[model samples]
Target: MKLKTLVGTFALAALPASMSFAWADAAPEMTDAERAQAKQIYFERCAGCHGVLRKGATGKNLEPHWTKTLQDGNKVEGGTLKLGTNRLERIIAYGTDGGMVNYDDILSEKEINLMARYIQQTPDAPPEFSLKDMRDSWKLIVPKDKRPTRQMNKINLQNVFAVTLRDAGKLALIDGDTHKIWKVLDTGYAVHISRLSASGRYVYTVGRDGLTTIIDMWFEEPTTVASVRLGSDARSVDVSKFKGYEDKYLIGGTYWPPQYSIMDGETLEPIKIVSTRGQTVDGEYHPEPRVASIVASMTKPEWVVNVKETGQILLVDYTDLKNLKTTTIESAKFLHDGGWDGSKRYFMVAANASNKVAAVDTKTGKLAALVDTAKIPHPGRGANFIHPQYGPVWATGHLGDAVVSLISTPSEEAKYAKYKGNNWKVVQELKMPGAGNLFVKTHPKSTHFWADAPMNPEREVAESVYVFDMGDLDKAPVQLNVAKDSGLPETTAVRRAVQPEYNLAGDEVWISLWGGKTDQSAIVIYDDKTLKLKKVITDPAVVTPTGKFNVFNTMHDVY
Candidate 1:
């Protein structure tokens, strides 16, 4: 509410220094229920007049307002029309044209008011990128010096910022640098997957209920700036390569009535909706490529989508959103995971829950190598959960338990600059052998890393976490000797832990342990180098909170 008065000045300052424009008005925020109701209004009364997808058959893209300037330049082409905030509101409140019926009397003023604000507001901004940009390359090693901020929170600098989908449809912001919580904002939906805008100004979350909410993390005071309704039953969202394109157009999939929708992130306007060949549940996908998981190549900035059910990896030219091309890979049981390995040269896939991590050359889409990562029998947890992480090497989790099936790639270039060149090797398999999920975080400098092998919950117990190094072939799993139980004695090794992430500073590793399958969970932090315990905090709100439990909430992943 206070933002309204200050937003005008903020907008003025945000204008590109090169451009000169008149004063603009600040938009209002919509209530959660109002946003939910707007979709119903869209389908019932509005779809016929404006194109259902909102790309101006009669109306505009609805998201991005259709009047936003093209990425190529500051000009508006194709006779695209623009509407002022008041004008757009009046049109919705009253009516337009002969066929478009007036909603003034039919719809309540409250409903009409929300749609007005929705049409006028720009898409939410992405979270700011804190890393310094180096043209060639960068590494994410842990930083030295351990200290808390003025707020008594740890200050970490190298951790990857991650958004966890709380069971209640809210999103919490955790500072990866300090292992301290920055803020937690209600997303207004049951969030599943999320992606930040390229500019790092907005954080977007797409939920299972088919709602996408964008938060303005760029501000010191994070807020859910906008909420857009995507339709029902949406799953995952991949950010389009085009940065700041109407607040990050997301390519997402749905469960029932199987289909994919490319939506304007800012306005939640459906740009193009396509039907898939098979329902995602059946795994009987057809050639109709609906987006399963979309991500842009860090190297070339091309948009890549993994058609999960079909095992299809579709690479689309970034220049033209329509210029899509596809190449199918062997069934990995999941299209949601796997992609060009760290090098961005070969496509990698987890083969049918097997320990075999397969790779294919992207150019030919043919199997190049089936790197056997330890001869362990495949644990049947359904292929859906057997996902891999992208690093200089490919790391996969086995459903069976504690064995982290790792596949190494040669770090040799004709001329490797910073790190030493090495040969292709099966650096040693560190075995903690058990029935737990595997989460891996790579160290910035060395080939050393850590994996969260859950043991139990509460009291005091000895749980083993592997801090092994995978150097050149001759070397085996060199466990980075850490002072076991050196710090945070309250953290018993018996509890189950979920996602363990490194702080931006790479100095500490934060682990979120399930409160013994109860309401008592703990957030533990480990010194990256010494493996000494830094802190252990408890949380009873492992899932949701009423009021008292809110204070106990620690994060799962660092931002």
Candidate 2:
């Protein structure tokens, strides 16, 4: 693709010195139509990894230049590194080996060319989202008093699975027992995660577009009762789950504006807004330090908020919003999603770029340990189970390496005392054929550990999943070709398998077969003990199935 030459020498020069002030005033190199289209494309695809402010996290920072202010009011400029339009276009079109998806087919040649030039100009900054903004955006679809007082459907609520239908901006709640689509409701675009409330009655979904929806399952058919917009882009959300505070409040973390907000869990009313902009653990001010992930504490009435750029884990006390108290625990930067350990006391999260796993002792409100691991650990809520040698261990898969690192975790039980010496260390690294893994999962009752390599560039490896025997860690993982098993015609796009979820009984495991929007997508179910294909759910509504959240498993914090 031919492009206009951008005059810059620095690496990925995405902006000029005065972009913050002149973005609206200056006429850009691209037309208004090109600029608006590129902005939408970046928010939906690039912002989650590169960040809304162009600060890098799971991906590289796309900022054009760096500036520093001296103590005496003098400004210093850093060395410039500009990725010219030619290089930028190729990288965006062909993608990188670092798990970035190539957009050659997804975007037209003209659109791809437009993006290359768009990044070369000053990136447009979004307007600040305030408390009044959230209040104005809030919508109470169904009144609380008008809702069902009891279970109105015969479907087992505990075994229902909230399936994210990507690209369609909808969610399909499937019955795990009958393997049928119970209901399909319109939702936010590219719903990132489906979080079940403490009571398993309300399903909360936070999308890439920052739209949060609460689905009430007690109705005859599952219905979206409330919804709200957090910002232009967001990822994680969790309901308060403590003993006395179950489903009272919800917390959401956003990629843009670098902040988190609290809302009423039942009505989706906005409560407060707190910005996460701060200095990194390295003691340098970062403009776009975002809240990467959030999970509610089982024991304490607090939320563990992971700040990506700042490398800070904030223990936010939700009990007092007016005088909010937060205990910040410093760890490694590039923090992403994670879950509780076997005992639910230590929360283990991946600091992806740091090549480390940070365990926070929620009981003590302190940083427990940071264990070094293989490259780019991408553990989506991680897996926790008993290892024959390590006793209780949490498992994480890597995107940059073909290994699943199992780290020993502490347990208070006398039966696990012998394995205490191996605590907070990588006990084993199970081998796989390739990397680019996104999620690894296991259940308390199941004897198998499931991991997916959805991000791998190779079609064969990307469309396959591996199951490790918990009883014998030395045995090779059982690789299942999910795409072949689906019996769907092969397309040019690789149908990647991702996000393995288990039923309430842990007897069945479900995997989402993620493909292109036009390509047919499916959810493949397998028997846990036999490792045999049990069911393949393919329908017009199942377009680009990505994440599946089992109600019982998610509500109870089962890995």
Give each model a TM-score: 0.55, 0.91
Candidate 2: the clashing residue pairs are: 10-80, 10-81, 10-82, 11-81, 11-82, 12-83, 14-64
| Steric collisions counted per model | 33, 7
After superposing candidate 2, which stretches have Cα over 4 Å from the reference? 1-28, 65-82
Candidate 2 — what's its lDDT? 0.86
Q: Rate the local accuracy (lDDT) of all candidates.
A: 0.43, 0.86
For model 1, how does the per-residue alpha-carbon lDDT over 210-304 read when each residue is reduced to its tens digit?
Answer: 56666554444555655554444454665554433433565656532245556555544455555555533345534333244455544343455
What's the distance in Å from true for residue 216, model 1? 1.2
Give the C-alpha miss distance for residue 422 in model 1, angstroms. Answer: 11
On the 0 to 100 scale, the lDDT of residue 292 in model 2 is 83
lDDT of 2 by residue, 199-300 (tens): 889999988888999999998889999999998788899999888899999999998778999999999999999999889999999888888889999879
Distance from true location, Cα of 63 in model 2, Å: 2.4
Best candidate, TM-score: 2
